[model samples]
Target: MRTINRTDFLSGLVVAALGAAGLVEALRMPRFEARGADPFTVPGLTPGLLSAVLCVLGIVLLLRGMSGRNLTEGAQPSITQWTRASAIRTLFTIVMVLVYGTLLFGRMPFFYATALFVFVFTVGAELIDTERRLPAWKLLIGGCLLAGGAAYAIDFVFTDLFLVRLPG
Candidate 1:
């Protein structure tokens, strides 16, 4: 039986690792202060801020786990009892995210890449859901709209509002 503390500890470690990695990558983004660009307008600014927050939250969780603060909550599902379906879903999401980050983001125009990723991820997730009630047609239509809308919004906000030049 795994206690909540143990689960939190493991989750926190993973979150912290991801956050730290993101922060490192964000830091590597070009800073145009040399060209008189505002520090807040740097491409890395938002990502760095978000990553730092994630890392701090993860550290807090790790500390709580280390202190066994949730021991009183008792045992939860054991590793052996973890559902195969759940594991597959988790792994699928992770792989999709990794592919989007490493392959898609910088390889294409931001709007197209983001739309593609969002569409594929939404459709794939819906298809994989055993209890999903939405039909394939609905999923397709919804995914398309969602992808387009989200991509447009993100692009508008970053490019127009934030003045961030998204990579092609």
Candidate 2:
């Protein structure tokens, strides 16, 4: 078993705390009983369920980390070691998500924007990954296909099945 370092302990604590906070917030959402809203359809239901799952997973992680068993084998990187490639990938993901959430999402048609974002994000991630074997043309084609399919599926689910109107 790998040694449960301070990083694992801290990560577990943070994740559990966040999950707890989310659950609390979800619980505080309006039930809408006066409007006869179905319990399953309540705004908080999904979040509450997801938060509970997170809380359970976090607790498991926390317990595992607290076990303090040391690995008898391979070397582990220190938590303080932030490689340049890792940092770049992290920053790129953050920037892409921020742009998608704050800029592209509501500014254009849902399908087009989502497709664009998915394509760019997939292509960018593949390009950034040092171990990626796909050539540029294949990457672009795969990205496009993935993006289009994902966007279409999401759009169809939300717009048709869930009956949720997406902002154009």
Candidate 3:
């Protein structure tokens, strides 16, 4: 029988590790006064929920990686996992994140920085993932919409619903 694919296994491990770590950290957060506070206004509420979701998703990924179907080329054949293109993409991602953290963070208004980050990341990811090319105009518009929607949702969740203030 074929073994699990290395990429799948590694991906699962990384995700699971991050999720577990996040869950631990989230659990350690102190509970706020709930006497007059909304139940959702607890400091750990969002983090705990997100961490749990991540853990579940990571476990699912791990199980999928262990399954013998669609993970590898075949039982006998060897397959290449990483290519130059993939390496370039990974490097690009690292650079993008670095720029976001060092340049956009604390330098611009939070929403504007988030908007740029989301738009660039989403557009790049979509372009890289799809083989069939989409029109640039469509991608640009879609990225803007996605970024705006995400920023609005996050702001509402943190500032309004959770009553947490965000840093610029």
Please count the clashing residue pairs in each candidate, in the order shown. Answer: 0, 0, 0
Runs off by more than 4 Å, candidate 2? 1-79
TM-score of 2: 0.54
Ranking by TM-score: 1, 2, 3
For candidate 2, write residues 35-146 as lDDT tens digits: 9989889999999989988988888778866886544446553666799999999899999999999999999999999999999999999999999999999999999999
Q: For model 3, which pairs clash? A: none
Sort by lDDT, top down from the best? 2, 1, 3
What candidate 3 gets wrong by more than 4 Å, as runs, is 1-81, 128-130
**Candidate lDDT (C-alpha), each:** 0.88, 0.89, 0.79
Report the candidate with higher lDDT, 2 versus 3: 2
Model 1 regions lying over 4 Å from their true place:
1-81
Model 1 agreement with the true structure over 51-102: per-residue lDDT tens digits: 9999989988887777766545356536535587788788889999999999
Tell me the lDDT of candidate 2: 0.89
TM-score of each: 0.56, 0.54, 0.48
